[model samples]
Target: MVEGDPAAPYTDATRARLEVAFAAYELADLARAAVPIGEHELSPDGTGRSAGATLADAAHVLGAARRFFEAAAVFERMAGADWELVGDTLGVSARAARDRFAVAEVCFREGANGPRGETSWWRAHLAEQPLEAARDLDDWVLRHRDGDGDLGTTPVSGGLVRRVNTGG
Candidate 1:
């Protein structure tokens, strides 16, 4: 639904929101498919449905829910939503929401393979660290326009090197 040049660079916020929107669309499609017309009717005695059918529906819905939650968590992080705000939206305690969504946020950032060097560090660190390590790296990449510095040559050690500028 997000129409634009595929090669055009997008800010992390835009990317995260687009991902969430896509995931929501997928979830809606799955929900519709899970209850096809004439197939979801339940009798008073519950005799029309087989155990397999019920289990399959349950699994499908659960999977879709998980994907939606992960996408939402990623979007919230990229939007710089505070844990308390996230918790209120999810009807949970601030600490509980943060604990649940931290891994998803970290995974989304780590999985991002952009031309820029900002997220490259996550890949290396995530590969060597346990998933629990994600909590420690929360908000490591600031999700704002000024967060990522301009790409240019900078001095490293004693010599100038071409790289993403870290506004130091």
Candidate 2:
């Protein structure tokens, strides 16, 4: 609303946020090793005032991509010490965040499956209605060791699926 400010110009805070997002995104890209960023990097770029925090944000955000698996791998490793951080770091409910974290983890696994970069966040999801389990789908399959090894496989629908432990 300033007189001299351009009409479409972004404010300092907004521009700073954009810069943060861009830097974080670039870092993720460099690390992804040829993976799609999708919309994960859009989260902490607007925030993350700290390096660890930004990296965590990047890990949580870009974790879904195969490249940033290392970044998210770090996050997954931390679960051993503080599992609660998953929710706070990823910005989701305890369960939902855990699910997203697992989503990122699997994306990396499928992308690289090891300590390498490779993933397709979009190809792993479904667009079906009436939300169903992730395992019900056949096209995508992901297993996370969050609690009791939540193993889930996606049907050909390619929507969101949840991990389940059938050994029970």
Which 10 residues in a row give candidate 1 its minimum summed lDDT?
Answer: 153-162
lDDT of 2: 0.37
TM agreement with the true structure for every prediction: 0.53, 0.24
| Tens-digit lDDT track of model 2 for 45-158 | 564244374466556555444333334433343335233565666665667655545544454334333333333232232222212312332222232123534344432223
Per-residue lDDT of candidate 1, residues 1-117 (tens digit): 222443343445544554454455556666767666354566667665555776777787777677677777778878789999999998999999988877767666766533222
Predicted candidate 2, C-alpha RMSD? 21.5
How many backbone clashes can be found in candidate 2? 21
Candidate 2's C-alpha runs over 4 A off are 1-70, 73-83, 107-168
